[model samples]
Target: MLHYLLTLAIFFAFFAVEAWGLNLQFGLTGILDFTYITFVAIGAYFAGVAAMTPSTNGGMGGSYIFGWQLPFPLSPVIGGIAAAMLGVVVGIIGLRRLRSDYLAIVTVSVGQIVWMVIGNATPLFNGWDGIVGVPQPYNSVMNLSTNNYEWPFLGISVIVAAIIFWLVRSLTESPYGRILRAIREDENVAAALGKNVFRYRMSAFVIGAFIAGISGALQIEYIGAWNPSGWTTLETFIVWAAMLVGGRGNNRGMLLGAFLVPVLFTEATRWITIPAHPLLMEAIRGMAIGLLMVLAVRFRPQGVIPERKRVFPLTTIPGLKEDVANGHTAQG
Candidate 1:
């Protein structure tokens, strides 16, 4: 039970990471990135392959392209880079003048295409079986029992989450983040102000993808495998739900929603006393998620912790008010 709880805590941390990525793209930048999970899968796959050998190992026999067995952080970092490269490609094609709705459609289509390719290309990602036996970071050195190892792993998870949280929070609060918000609110206005909307959106998309990749790489390390089925479009929706339920534009809300939707609802459903087919439980979980999303949208669209309004007081800037006044006087 302790192990299970520790696992859940780790999951919460990773889910928070994913939520932050989506929030940056969709909430902050107004990007409807439905292909988000594709990047995550890419990250997981790369990280898994990087950490394994070409031969079968770790309770699952599979062969992959790369098996460098790189050290702790390098594999995940490579995964993140791979995801970001894909993001650049997708952003260039999809972020160039499409409306939000159309962009969403394109992203969905891209995700489907990628999924089909990964599932069918046996050489790539071992088809549906995926690559397994991804080594936990620094496990060889630690050489602890399974349960004992989890304690330190849990600490690592929290630290990673903190770094990502700090990075995103800082970026969102910076001037660049304000520009992203402006784009989300009114892209046309931002464009009119000489902002290169496409560049900004692409940057956000790539950065968000990189973060998603990191989360996926970490998850693969924990789970010891990566498969196409694990990264369905539904996973993307779940992240979106987390952001919405928490608060789209609020970082703290991401953590809250991550706990409620993914951690709470997901874990709680497993023990539900339903006298139905076991497979039905999975369906029920989906229904619960759908219902939660609906309720959140209909009753509390702004989320439990809505984004705080940002206000700029002109008086706060030194001499700015006087400068403006003098300019007006001179003009008059």
Candidate 2:
């Protein structure tokens, strides 16, 4: 039971990472990034390729580049850099030109393109079968049993999650975060006020992509595998659903939604008896999630925890109150 709980904690950590990234992109910046999971896949594959040994001893005969036998800790850093580069390209191409709806479609196409290329191109990252046998960090130093190792890893995951939460929360409260919200609320108004809307949007996109990459790297390290099958476009929506249900603009709400939807609801489905075929059951689950999303949107669009209103001090600006009072007196 303790082991099970530890495993659940690890899952929650990763889910929280994903949700937080999405919240930054869609919730705060309004990117509508349907290709978010593509970054995750890139991160996982990059980390897997980096951490795996070049010799095909445990790789199941799969071949890939950058098998420098690098340490596991460095893999996620490389993965994050790769994902950020991809985000830059995608943001320039899609975010700079297209409106939200068209940009979403283009992003979806990009995700499909990446998935197909990875699945079909056998020379890159082991193609469809994907890379395997990713090594864990510091495993040799501790030399612990597999079951026992998870306990420390769970601690590591919690630490990572907390750090990410703090960083994201801080970002959301900063001046830049206010700009993002302004752009999200009305890009025209932000632009008219001389704010570089595109720049802020791109920044948010790349930042979110970086975080997504880290999350993917952490997850793949724990699972010891990276595959195309794991990163479908639909997976992006799952994160979005969590954001919507929990509260899009609220970080704590996003965390709650992440735990409730991805960790709890998904796991709960496994125990429920379903007489239908496995595919049918999966379809039913998808439908149920869709219905839940619709219900949440209709009834609680602001999310479980609505975004907090930012309050500015009236005394911050000199003479502002006197000018307001003078105008009121003139009107009287």
lDDT (Cα atoms) of all candidates against the true structure: 0.86, 0.83
Measured on C-alpha atoms, candidate 1 has an lDDT of 0.86
TM-score: model 1 vs. ground truth: 0.91
* Worst-scoring 10-residue span by lDDT in model 1: 54-63
Best by TM-score: 1
Q: Which runs of model 2 end up more than 4 angstroms from their true locations?
A: 55-59, 273-276, 312-332
Cα error, candidate 1, residue 237 (Å): 1.3
Once fitted onto the true fold, the runs of candidate 1 whose alpha carbons sit more than 4 angstroms away are 56-60, 273-276, 311-316, 319-332
> Where does candidate 1 clash, by residue pair?
none
Shift of residue 150 alpha carbon in model 1, Å: 1.2
Q: Residues 1-332, candidate 1, lDDT per residue (tens digit)? A: 88888988999998999999999999899899988888888888888888876654333566567888988688889889999998998887788864787778878998899899888887767888887678888888989877888888888889889999998999899989999999998999999999889889999999999999999988998888888878886788788889899999899999999999888888645677567576788777777778888999999998999997878776687867886766653453
Instruction: Give the lowest summed-lDDT range of ten residues in model 2.
Output: 323-332
